[model samples]
Target: MSADHAHALPAGVRPPTYHHFEDLAQQEESEKLGMWAFLITEVMFFGALFTAYTVYRNLYPEAFMDASSKLNWKLGAVNTLVLIVSSLTMALAIRAAQTGKYSQVIWQTVATMIFGATFLVVKYFEYMHKYHDGLMPGPTLFFTDVFGEHTPQARIFFSIYFAMTGLHAFHMVVGLGILTWVLIKARKRYFTPDRYLALENVGLYWHFVDLVWIFLFPMLYLLGAHYGLGH
Candidate 1:
């Protein structure tokens, strides 16, 4: 919708509908609130997965550590760095929106997309390596080899691994789509210093993505530390 349409709100009355809010500030606030609420639910959603992962890891410490060792920590670490930088740039993009720096906002969002793409590229390689090794979610080659014959329980660990990481990666793709749209809108100056609800909402979503990785890193990569795997 165009700014002209935005100003067509009833006098002194902004609809509680944030996307249609006449007052830009009110819209931004509503967007932020809605984003936070959505993020809270996301946290809970991933939290359940994390809890299940933890329980399984505890159940088979050796198998879990062995599985963890199979992961490419170097790639994981680099992707973590990329995402952290992307989060910083995303936050800066929001600040740029607040200041009405349309070009800066567009570029920052573009930079974030690049970093996000890099992360996905790395993830692609990681997934490819695992798949080629037959380490997918199933009772097939993923087990019986990677986790050692003694560690049958590790198959369950890898199952959760694929499910959790796969879902997280899917969210990254969604965020990338949102950022791309925001970039186009920013380039067209759809967001004024007063009316950048889209930017604010996307920022909130991006931050939530980062937060999920914060938990995933420790849970997936660092969970088996200090455990005696007998490897």
Candidate 2:
């Protein structure tokens, strides 16, 4: 594509060539590799937190179970379902972008944002419940005698729970912002069947966020299910 022709294309649709990239395929591959590299860093970051939680749970299994029992598993499950649906919609949005169906892309992305917002709303309620119960995992923490002398150990569990889930929620907010930006360009009639590198990157991120929750829902909420505490 010539300079004038490339400039004439919709801004959100990537050009067929750039000064740095040999061709559209090379540009697309570079973009995907960059996103994957960033995602690997994210995985390492989350992995450290998971490792810490694992060590603590192994050392204080009873305390972990007791603390996990107090969490609202039902709310966690609801959030899990919300994310699953959001992932589906996000995938559909990418497919639409690939098919050059701009309208479908917009609606599907909107569905993704709505479901993501729903997950956060449910999380807000859960946080408020814990806050009201003095279980927010801070200097104000008061686990009650329900946890007995294991309260201290359980405090560790709450701290990690808040850290992991709070980070996950932050990611959702960021993903929503990206989707909004994409939606704006989409409204302006951007991207063609072969020019959706940004949208593809966003899809990878949205799916990663959902995958994290998939691990979190079971690790944090369902650990004590057999004992009837998490159920």
Candidate 3:
């Protein structure tokens, strides 16, 4: 048989295999499944931080409360609200993408990114305040004022607070990066009404981030705020 009849072999060119579904749909489903797996791991990752926090708080109630009192609940609460709004926007973005509303998806994604950035900015200010006040959790410095001279347990409280909040902030940064990629793809109109798994998975991730913050707010901020007193 001639070369043309022998599958038309070309240098460095490979024949494509026929898939049951089109490439785009297959890719979309695969991406969605991958995102769900990633979210599950994220849950486990944050779970460890929470467990550590619980252990420390249970061991040093007074020190924990003292440290918790120093946190600016007003700022934390505002951030919580910001993240909640972002979650809603992210979900809406997914819906927009599913309905082939490219403009809406792009705008909603931008809105979500803005809220994510706002959360980071607030967290930065909080960290700055803590650092300036010498509230770090260790013998390095600043524990005396934060926990009083006699209380050594304050270090533990600060340790857990830093661990939990810092981890959450890192995840927020990751989410922002993910959203940036999604925005680029959305701008290119890569997603269609029937194949928008990327948007949906990112929505799941956004909600998970929001959920983690919901738990963190109460655990790190409200757990020891005079609720356990006189019990």
For candidate 2, write residues 139-193 as lDDT tens digits: 5685344578898888899999999999999999999999999889778657556
How many backbone overlaps does candidate 1 show? 0
lDDT tens per residue, model 3, 81-165: 9999999899889877666677788999999999999999999999988887777654554436535652567777777788888
Worst 10 residues of 1 by lDDT: 8-17
TM-score of each: 0.83, 0.91, 0.82
Candidate models: Cα lDDT each: 0.78, 0.87, 0.78
Cα deviation at 13, candidate 2, in Å, is 5.4
Which one is best on lDDT? 2
Assess the local accuracy of residue 162 in candidate 1 as a C-alpha lDDT between 0 and 100. Answer: 88
Worst lDDT run of 10 residues, candidate 2, spans 1-10
* Cα error, candidate 2, residue 212 (Å): 0.6
Question: 95, model 1: CA deviation in Å?
Answer: 0.9
Q: Which stretches of candidate 3 lie over 4 Å from their true place?
A: 1-31, 137-143, 227-231
Off by over 4 Å in 1: 1-28, 224-231
Name the runs in model 2 displaced over 4 angstroms.
Answer: 1-14, 142-145, 229-231
Pairs that collide in candidate 1 are none
Task: Report the error of model 2 at residue 116, Å.
Answer: 0.3
